[model samples]
Target: MKKYQPFLLTILLLALFPALAKSEVPIQKGERLNLSRCVETALRNHPVVQGARDTIRIGESRIGQAQANYYPQVNWQTDYTRINRSRTGNSTYSDYNSSVVLSQTLYDFGKTKTSVNIEKLTTDSFRQDLHRAETEIVYGVKSAYFSLLQAEKNRDVAVETVAQFQHHLTQAKGFFEVGTKPKFDVTKAEVDLSNAVLNRIRAENDLRIARVGLVNALGIPSAPEFSLDDSPLFQKEKIDLADALERAYRNRPDLQSIGKKVEAADESIKLARKGYYPYVTGSAGYGYSGEDFPLRDGWNVGALLNVPLFSGFQTRYAVEEAKASLDVLRANEASLRQTIRLEVEQALSNLREAQERTEATRVAVRQAEENAELANGRYDAGVGNPIEVTDALVSLSNARTAYIAALTDCRIAQAGLEKSIGKRD
Candidate 1:
């Protein structure tokens, strides 16, 4: 992925362009990707998303390990020993014993249960982590997608404005040839026309950069050309900040992950506490010991209970460690909740402010258009200086650009708000 300085101080920017955004190529006619398609493809193919999937699978594999402790352990042993005693006068004997001994923990006061619970919680935590990763990827994709769209639209506007300025420049020169307009007017007109061409060139470059950004966001191989499906992001909708914040708290996958972490820590505390209790085990075995040709058979079964008398305060320290882990998780959860609240509030404000700015900028564009027309008429009728016309033209172009910026801001803010809400995929 190409990186660029973030002039917008937001989530999107790039360098290194495909330069083929508008180039003629036989597009392979792949399925056009919208937000949903981008998200689906990213979930399936993105490295981060795939890595998260692997973690969840590991979590699943660990459940088997957690359950394996419940099964009995059986084994066989065989050994031969040579005995020589001075009293026996150099006599030697061989003894061998072989048997299958099965041993299982009868009880540990819910230790296994607690451990299983912790493992299950860990599995759930990773699932939420996957969801969080997918959410972030979605935001990245949306930002790049909208950026490309806006750049293309801006390029179209720049091209049209250049054509208009060139027509005006031609009219200015024709008037000059007739010995009516002054040379200064023709020079100013040419300068404006060149500026318009410069704007078009810049817009074209920007569009290419935006295309590179989209390609990176999609996490696909570098492509010469890619087309996104046309899908408008805007829709009129009412937002209830209160409800949204509440839902975000419940649904945000990162928070849910912390909650699971806390649960696992709690279970760990229980498992550690189990160390203070007695460990009970049941065992059964059958074996034969022979000193001669005939075989001696024997069988034994017993229950063993072991109480931790003292282990240099190991159990106590382990329980304390578990408690400390839980405390850390609780503190982290509190901090995370506060951060989520701030993000949601900021994104909401940005969206509403962008909405207002879009309206104001729309009016500004109309005003700038009127001002440009008035200046043009005044200049043509010999009541305005060429400088005044140039100023008005510059103002008009700036107003149009600002209007586009406001629209782009509104769309991006909306996407960001959805991210903050955590209901987005």
Candidate 2:
């Protein structure tokens, strides 16, 4: 029974506080997280994405509030009052009143309809904002995922370099003991080995930092340590600049959101102008009023007309303010369109550059690897100097590093381009 007690307690806690369970680490140690999984986790858990979704809900609620004016409003009121007639007869009386009233808008010169339409448009805008948040989260996850991969590759390169230097050191010591290579060869190899070890340490630390970055991008800072599935970083995506620009213009969520805002602003201007017209409201009430029991009962119905009449130029200023706001939104929409074009062009340019670098570095790494092998072989044959061996190894390391960087850049550039074009998935 005691053995089951702890398990029962755990279940009880989880049932009582579901949020506590949600706060636990989302990923398990040694779990392999892929790019898609990371993006999904981010979209599901990121505070920004959650907040954006909440904003959409708020906008939806506002739409309901605006439409409420089209429906009848009911209210019930009860009050008791003690009146003193001292000025007339020094007499006091108690009065009680109770009433239930229903009021509905009869006409508002399209004001209610326009207001509801504006709210609907604004809600659509918020939906687009949510899409934008999702796109941004996806891009952040992709960029961080690629960065972690790059760091992992760089760390591997460092480890390999360290191993090669260790081998060289062993070869140098063997040659010196056999009276073939100078003590200088042994000393140089030792120094190079030490430097490679230092680089490996730095690389390991960088890999750790990259992992932290990836976890942050996942929006799960307390997630357990996990491995990532290696994605193809060198794959080139074929995209036309014209097509990308067109897609960005057509699909960018920020642009779409702003466009919706512009439409809403147009309606806002109309709503503001409606202040110059009269609005009609019809009301009906049933009530009982008396100072004692068995109170008299009565019912009444009436229609009220509200006119702006004279408002000290308040309506004029409201109309001007609305028009100015609309103008501002239009300007912003134009600026956002231009910004989208620039982003698409920049992403495309970066992707092209990274592709070119990847191809060039691929060749460089191959050549450097061959050169390192030849240099090591020649040294083993007592034909190559320690300087040549060291330079060849360094060149190989640099080439590998460059290749890793190019691949990472390619992946990040693709992510940026997708985000620029508002690729939600």
Candidate 1 backbone collisions, by pair: none
Worst 10 residues of 1 by lDDT: 8-17
Whole-model lDDT per candidate: 0.82, 0.93
lDDT of 1 by residue, 1-425 (tens): 23544554333322333444423432234545576776666566678888999999999889878887799989898788777776878778877777889999898898877888899999999999998988888888888888887888788888978876786787688878998788877898888889899999999999999988877776764544656764554543457689779988989999999999999999999899888899899999998889765769899999999999888999899999999999999999999999999999998898889889889988999999999899889867767777777788778878888877877788788778778878656
Q: Write the per-residue lDDT of candidate 2 for residues 1-425, one digit (tens) a residue.
A: 99999999999998999877765767768888888888888998899999999998999899899989989999998999999998988989999999999999999999989999999999999999999999999998999999999999999999999999999999999999999999999999999999999999999999999989988888888888788888656566789989998899889999999999999999988998999999999999999999987889999999999988999998899999999999999999999988998999999999999999999999999999999999999998999999999999999999999999999999899999999999976
> For model 2, what is the C-alpha lDDT against the true structure?
0.93
- Candidate number achieving the greatest TM-score relative to the actual structure: 2
| Candidate 2, superposed: residue stretches over 4 Å from native | 1-25
Q: List the residue pairs that clash in candidate 2.
A: none
Enumerate clash totals for all models, in the order shown: 0, 0
TM-score of 1: 0.83
